[model samples]
Target chain A: MAFSAFASAPAAAEPAVRRRSWVALVLLLPGILYLLLFFITPLVSLVFTSFQQPVIGGDIGQYSAGFKWENYTESVTQYLPLILRAFGYAVLATVLALVISYPLAYFIGVKVRSFPLVQSLLLTLVIAPFFISFLLRTLAWKQIMSDEGPIVVALKALSVFPNDGHITGTPFAVVFGLTYNFIPFMTLPLYATLERLDVRYIEAGNDLYASPFTTFRKITVPLSLPGIVSGTLLTFIPAAGDYINASGDFLGSAQTSMVGNAIESNFLVTQNYPVAAALSIVLMAVILVIVGLYVRRAGTEDLV
Target chain B: MAAGTFAEKGADLELVGITKTFPGFTAIQSLDLFIPAGSFFALLGPSGCGKTTTLRLVAGLEEPTAGRIVIGGQDVTATKSFQRPVNTVFQSYALFPHMTVLENVAFGLRRRSIASPLEKAHEALRLVELDHLAARRPGQLSGGQQQRVALARAVVNRPALLLLDEPLGALDLKLRRQMQLELKDIQSEVGLTFLHVTHDQEEAMTMADTIAVMNKGEIEQMGAPEELYELPRTAFVANFLGQSNLFTGEVSGSTPDALTVAIAGQRLIIPTARAPRRKGTVTVGVRPEKLLLLTSAPAPSSGSNALGPGRVIDVSFSGVSTQYTVAIPGAGDVVVFAQNMVFGPVVHVGAEVWVSWNVEHGFGLEDSVEEAAAGVQDAAAAQSADADTRTGVTSSVRA
Candidate 1:
C-alpha cells in the first residue's frame, strides 16, 4: 500500500502544482486591481497632465491636453530652489537618523540579547513614538520651539539668538522635525538586521588578534551594510515627499518651502494642475535616480 | 625568537588546579594536566562533559576560577585570548565571509606587523593545498575546502599551541577520515603542540598520542589508546571505551600468579596481576573478544585458564567476526567474539557450548562499598604495578 502511494505521488504532483498556481493568481487579483486603480491610472493621468498647455486668459487655472512640454520646464524654473531644499533636508535628516539609530539598534540587538525582558522593552521604546499621530507630534514640536516657548526664551536670554530672532518657520526646525519623526523608520530595519548577526564572528575576530575597534570596523560594519542601506531608504524616501513637516503653516516659512509644499499650494490654492503634476513627476524621477545610484554604490540588491 | 621563523621545538602546556563555575553549575572541577612538548593530546568525552571547556581554558578564551596556566615556561594565566600564543579552528569554521581566502589567512600576520604577509599566506595556503583558490571568498568554497582554509588561517601564525575544537566534525564521514590522516601529517610537519577536543572515540584513539577520557567534568582515565582499551581502571572506563562482560564473585583463594574464585559451584582462576587489590568480593571483567565459544570444555592445561559451561542464546555474523551470546548458569548473558579465520562450524541459537579464556585476560574491580573504600587507598598501589606486565597480557590478547 505504501509503495503504491509513493509510486503515484509524482503523477499527482503536476495537477496539484497547476491548481496551486491558479489559486495564487486568484489570491493576487485584489492587490493587482488595487494597484491598477489607485497607482497606475493616476500615474498615467499625471504624466498626461504634465504635458498640458494652459489656456491663454482662460479662467484662474484651466489647461488643455497638448504637446506643450513647457509646463515641465516652467515648473522646474519656478520651484527649482524648493526642490533642491527638499532633497537637501531629506538627505540631512536621513544621515542624522542613521548616525543616531545605528548604535541604539546595536545596543538593543546585541548587548541586551541575554536580557530578554530588557531587550523587548527597549525595542518597544524605539517603536512607541508610532502610537501618536505624526502630524500632531510635528505640531507639538512647533509649539515647543515657538518664540514664546522656553527654549527660544532661554536662547534669547543666553544671547544665543538675537532678541527679535525666532526658531519657528525656519529650515532648521523643518529638518529637525523630519529627523525626529523618521528615526523609528531608520531604527527598525537596522535592528532587524543586527538582531540576526552571529556573535561568534565577532569572537573569531578577537581570537585572530584584532582589537575591539578593529573588529567592529572590519567585521561588524561590513556585515551590517544591508541594514544601513535599507534604513536610509526607509527614512529618505518618505521624507523627500513629506509636506506636513515642511508646510508654510507648520515648521516652514515662505522662504523655507520645499517641493512638497510647492506641489500642495499649486494644486489646492493656485489650482495649477499641470504645474503641480509636473513638479510631482520631477520629484519622483529625481528620487528614483538618486536611490538607484546609492543602492548601486552600496552594492546591495533591490530595495528592502 | 626571530620574527616569522617557526621554532622546530614545540611548547609545553601545564594547567594547575583549574576550576570553572557558571552562575549555578560548575563546568569543571579543580583539575591538573600536563602536555609534554610536541605531543598530540586529546580531550575525549560525551557532550557537556567539559572537554570543550578545558580546551577553551587552555586557549585563554575562558578564565579559570582558580588556576594557573603555563605555556613554554611562561605564566600566561592572566593573558587575554588575543595575547595568548595560541589559535583555535572554531567548530563553525568562522571564516570572514567578506574577505578573500588570502586576506583571511593573512589577518593574523597583519596584526603582528609581519612584513610581506601575502607571501607567507600563500605559503600557508599551499600547505593546505588551497593556494589556487586564494582569490575566492569563503562562501564560494565547499565544506571540506572551507575547513582547509580555516586550518591554513590558523596555522599561518605558527602559534605555540594549535587547538582544534571538533575540527573535522562538519565534514562527511569519508572526508573526516581522510582529513584525520592529513591533520596528523600537518601536526608532525609543523611540530606544534596540537590539543584536539572531540566526542568521537575513534577520532581521539586514531590521532592523539595521549588521550584523556572525561566524565561528568573529571578525567576517568588517561593513558595510551591500547592501555586504556585493554586495561581500564574503573567500571566507567571499561564500559565507556568498549564492551565488557563483568562477573561479580567472591575470592576463594590466592596464589603468587593466580586468584581462585568460586561462582555458582564453579571454580575460575584469575591472573594475580589482573586481580583486585582487596579480594573479598570483586567484579571480574573481560572484553568480548577475549571470551571464546567452543563445542565442548577443553582440558585444564594450566591454573591460569578459565572454562565455563553455557548455552548459546544468540549468534550474529559481522563480516570478520562472529558474535555469540551465551547464558551461563550464574553469569547472566555473556557476549563472545570469535574470529572467522577459517571455515568453522557456525553456532546456532539454543545450542549448548563452553566459554573459555586465558586467566590473564580477566580484570577485577572492587564491587562492594566496603571494599571500594579500601580501593581508594590502593589506587596509587595499583599504579605502581609495572607497565611491562600490562603489555605482556595485552600483546598476547592481540595475537
Candidate 2:
C-alpha cells in the first residue's frame, strides 16, 4: 500500500512536468511530421498495396473495397526457389569475402599501424573500385570473360577448362562479381574493429605460456567477433538485394536472377504492383529474421 | 667478470649486461642484475628511465641487443616468451575481455600439456581469494578485483619468476596501499621471486626487499630501501629516491673516518667511515628528516655539524609534519622537515633557526662530483651532434 501511494504521488505531480514536456514536443513537431510523412507513410502504403488489387479505373481506392490474398500466395509458390537462390549466393559471397578480407584487414590495421602511408594506400585501393559506376564495372567483367578476352584464351592455353567460349551467363560469375563488389564493405569494418583492439592482450597471452597460434585463436579471434558479425551483415544484406550484375551483361540467365531481378521485372515490365510489393515484403522479412538472430547471438551492443 | 652462481633452491633469474636499443636510441644499456632466489626485487626509476624495459627483457617480450638472460639457472636469452618459465602482469592488467574470471585464470593451464586443468585453476583462484568471482567476466569486475584476477592468472602457472610491470598503477591511492601490502604478503606466502617495475618511490620502499634505482639506461644505485635512503652514493640517487638537501663543497681536510668540507664559507665535517677515498671536491647530502632545528646553539661536540646561519624563508605545515626552507650565506636554499611532536606553537615563516646534523647523518659524494662534471661536458657535446642530425632529418622529411 505504501508503494502504491508513492507511485500515485509521482503520478499526480507528472501533469505539470508533462505540460512543460509539451514544449519540447512542439519543438520536435517538424522532424516527427517529416518522418511520418516520407518514411512511415510509404511503408504503410506498400503494406496495404501488397494485399490489395487495382480497380477497373486503376485507382488506389480499390484497396478499401477488396483484398487479394493470391498476391502473397502466388509469390511464395512461384518465386520461392529464386528467393532461396539469392540467399544462397549472398551467403556464399559474404563468407568468401570474409575469408579473403580478414587477414588483409588484420595486417593493415595491426601490423602496419606504424606506417600511416601504407595503411592509407591500402584503404584507397579497397575504395578505388567503387568510384566506377556499378553498370560499367559489371560490363567490364563481362568483356573480360568473353571468348576473345584474355581470360578465355589463357584458360584454353592452360587447359583448365574446355575452351568454353564465354563463362558470362553463369551463377558462378554472378556470385564472383557480387563478392568482388562488396569486399570493401567487409574489409573496412573489420579493419576499424581490429585497429581498436589492444595489442597488449596478445602479449598477455604470450606471458600466460600460449603459443602464437593459440594466442591468435584465443584472443584475436574472439575479440574481433563484433567486427566479423558487423562486416558479414553489411556485406550479406546488400549482396542479397543486388540484381544489377545478375541482370546485366555479366550473367543474363534465368538461373542467376535474384529477388531484385524479380521485383524489377514485376514493376517495370509486368506492371504487377501487388506481386512486387509482396516480393519486397518477403525479402525484407527474411533479412530481418536472419539479422535479428545474428545480432541476438552476438549481442546488440556488438552489432551497433 | 664477477658472475655469481645461482642459488641451488628457489627461483633464480639473472640478466648479464642486457641491452636494448631502438633505431637510433638506446632504451637500456648493459644492465647487469640478478634477482636472488625467492626475493622481491624492485626496478625503480622516474618515467622513461628504462626500468620497464628491463622487466620486459626478463619477461622475454623484448630481446636484448647484447646480453644473456637466465631463469631458474637456464639460459633463456634466445627463447620466446611463451617458452620461458616467466609470466607478466602488464600495467593495464590485460585480462581477456571475452573470458570469465575462471577462464582467464585457467588460460595458461588449459594451454599446458597437463591432465587436470580445472583443479589447478580453482586452487590458483582460491589462493588469490578470487574464487567467488569465477563466473564474472573481467569487464564486470572492479579495478581491484581485476587486479586480483590478473595476479591469479599469473600465479597459476607456477612459473619460476613473476614479472609485474606497474600492476597496481591503475588503482586509486587507498586501494594501491592495500595492494602493496597484499602483494608483499603474497610473495612471501608463495615463495616466488618477483621482479616488479615501478616509478613510485613509496611503493618500491614498501614492497621490495632490494630496490635498484635506475636513470637514463643505467642503474644508479641498488641496495635495501632504507640503506639507499640513508646513504645515497650519488646526488642523482639522493634526489631520485627521496627529497634531500644537497650542498656542493670542496674537501678541506680528511681523517681516516671523517672529512671536513667547506660549504658556503662554513666548514662542516662529514663522518665518512664508508667513503671510497679521501676526497677533493664533494657534494654533501642529508635527508630533510635528519636535519634538526635548534632555537639556541649547543655546546661544541665532536660529531655535531652546522650548515647554515641564515633566516627561514618559508614554512609549510603539512598535516603530520612541518617543512622549513632555510637560506644560507652562499647556498640558495635548504629544506628541513620536522615531525609534529605536540600541538604547540607552530614555526613562524621568518624565524631565525640553526640547521644542524650529526656527522654520521651526512654522506660525502666527492667521487660522484668528478664523474658528474665529466658526464655533463660529454652530454653537452652529444646534444649538439643530436641537434644537427635532427635538423637534417627534419629537412629530408619535409622534402
Candidate 3:
C-alpha cells in the first residue's frame, strides 16, 4: 500500500515539477541571451581581431582580413613599455586607494555603527563627488594645480619648490587624480563587506586571547580580503582606462599619457581605424591578463 | 599547572551588588554572588531572567551599573574583557570561522603573558580529547566537535573562571544530553571554576553542583541541586526549578517541625524544614513523584499528614512512567507521576484514586502571591522613579 501511495504521489506531482522547471527556464532565458549577445560575442570578436591584420584595397573593401602574427609581436615589443607603464599607474592608484580607504571603511562600518548620523554624513561625503560630472571634477583639479592657482602659491610660500612651482601636467598629478576619483569605489565595497562581517568572529578571537590588533590583522583583514581584491579590481581597471581624468587633469603630458590616451588618440584624433582596433585589442588583452591573474590569486568567489 | 589550582591560587570570582539597567528596563538588580574555587555552578532561569546578564557582568563584557566584580581576588569591575583573567564560550560557540581548531585553541595561549603557546594549547586540546581534529576548521567539524573546540579554546588560558552561556542550547536533544555528561566530566577533570548560565532546568540540575534559580533579575534561591529540588523555598523556585504540585492554604497552627494548614476546607499538616517566616497564608509544595497513588486509601498511614480522594482526570504514558493528572474535591488538578513497574493494567481516565503524601514529602511556603502582587506595584513605582531620575540626570548631563 505504501509503495503504491508513493508511486501515485510522484505521478501526480510530475506535472507540477515540470511546470516549475519550465518557469525556471523562462526566467533564465533573458540573462542567457544577454550574456551571449553582449559578452560572449564581443569577447570572441576581440580575440579574433587580435590575431588578424587589416588589408588595404581588398576585394571586400573592409571585410577581408588575414591572420598576422606580426601584429601581436610588434605590439608586444614596441608598445610593451607603455602597456607596462599603464599597468604600473593602475597598480599604484589601486594600492593608494586601498591604503587610504580601508581605515575609512572600517571606521564607518564597524566603529561608527552606534552613530547613524555621523556614518551617513561620512558616506555622503565619500559619495558626493560622483554626483558631479567626472570631467568637470577632473577639470577642477587642473585649475587647482595650475601655476597661478592657490596650490602653487602655497608651495612657493613654503619654499618647497621654485617660485614658479606647478604640479599640473605631471604623472604625480595624474596618479593623484586617479586615486581621488576611485577611493569611493574602493571604500564602498569594503564598507559593505566589513559591515556584514559577523562580529562574533572578532569576539571569538578576543575570547581566544587575541589582542585587538592581532584580531584585526588575523581575522578581520583575511576575512575582508575578498572585498579588498574586488575593490582593487574595480578601481584599477577603470583608473587604467581613464583618459578623461588623466588627459584633462594632467594635460596629456608625455610621461603621464596612459593606454587610455593612446586609445583616444588612435580612435578619435588620429582616426587610424586599423591601428585603433589593434590598440583596443591589445589594451583588452593586457586588462584580461591582469584580471585573470588577480582572479586566480584571490579566488573567483571574491567577485561574487 | 593542575586543575583547581586557580582556586588554590585564590577565590575564583565575586560579584557584589551587581546591577545593570538598560534604557527602560532593569536587567539585573543588585545581585551578590560568589563562585567558589572549582565548582560547576549554574545560573538557571527562564528567558528574560538576567542570567546571561550576570554571566556577561562576570566576563567584563558588561559594566555593572552599581557594583564591583573581583576575579581571583583582584578587582576587575572596570577592566576590559580582554584584560580580565577569564574566558567565555558564547551561546553560539562563536568559534572563529577563519581559524582552524588548533589555531582557535592556540589563540588564548598565544596571548598569554606567560606560558608557551604550543605546550598550553596541546594540553588544553588533550583535555577536551580534540587533539586529533586540531587541523580542521570549526566549519569542517561536527556540532559536538565544534563545541569541544570552543571549550578547548577557553580552557587553554586556564583563566580564573570559565563562563559558559547556554553552550549546549543549540544542540539536538541527544547531543545535548551527551554534552551535558561530557561537560560535567570535563569540569571535573579540569576543576576550573565554571559559571554556566542556562534556562534548561534539567541541564542545570544534571551538570551543576550548585544551582541558582533566577527570576526577574533576582535570584529566587541558590543551593545544591538536590536541596533546591527537594526543598525549594518558594513557589517560584519550586516551579521554576522543576515541576511541582502547589496547594495554597492559610496556616492555622505551627509546630517546631510541621505546620497545620487549611487547604480547600481540608486540614493538612506539612513539614517546615525549609519554610521561611511561616506565620500567614502559605503554599504547600509537593513534587509529583512524591505523591503515591493507592488502589484503596491506606489506614491513615503514620507520618502521612495529607490524604485526599481524587479522580484521575488524565493518564499519559511516558517512556519510563505513567503520569496521571488527579483532581481533588474543591481543589485544582495535581499531577502524579508513578514509575512504570510492569504492564499490569493501565490507569484509565475518570478512575477514582486516593492521592496522599507523607508530611516529610511536602514543605510550606510563606504566601508569596500577595508579595508577588505587591512586587508588581513596587516595580512599577520604581520604574517611574527611575525614569524621573534618568531624565533629571540626562538634563544635568546635557547641561
Among all candidates shown, the one with the greatest lDDT: 1
Model 2 clash pairs are none
Error of 2 at B21 (Å): 2.4
Per candidate, native contacts kept equal: 0.54, 0.75, 0.52
* lDDT by residue (tens digit), candidate 2, A168-251: 778888888888889999999999999888999999999887889999998998898888988999999999988886785465
lDDT of 1 at B187: 92
Best-performing candidate as measured by DockQ: 1
- Proportion of native contacts in model 3? 0.52
Ten contiguous residues minimizing lDDT sum, candidate 2 chain B: B1-10
lDDT of 1 by residue, A177-210 (tens): 9999999999999998899888877877877777
lDDT of 3 by residue, A1-304 (tens): 3355547777877887666576778999999999999999987775566555556665432433567656566756765666777788889999999999999999998889889899999999999999998878888888888887888888898898797555877778888888988999999999988887878778777665567898888789878988898899899888877786557435336767777777777657755344545666788777889899888886636321
Better of 1 and 3 by DockQ: 1
Runs in model 2 with CA error above 4 Å?
A1-39, A42-74, A115-118, A300-304, B1-10, B113-122, B345-351, B370-399
Off by over 4 Å in 3: A1-84, A111-129, A143-162, A248-254, A272-282, A299-304, B1-11, B113-132, B294-302, B342-348, B351-353, B372-399
Interface RMSD of 3: 12.5
List the DockQ of the predictions in order.
Answer: 0.35, 0.32, 0.24
What's the true lDDT of residue B325 in model 3? 92
TM for every model, in the order presented, reads: 0.84, 0.85, 0.82
Q: Which pairs clash inside model 3?
A: none
For all candidates in order, the CA lDDT equals: 0.84, 0.82, 0.78
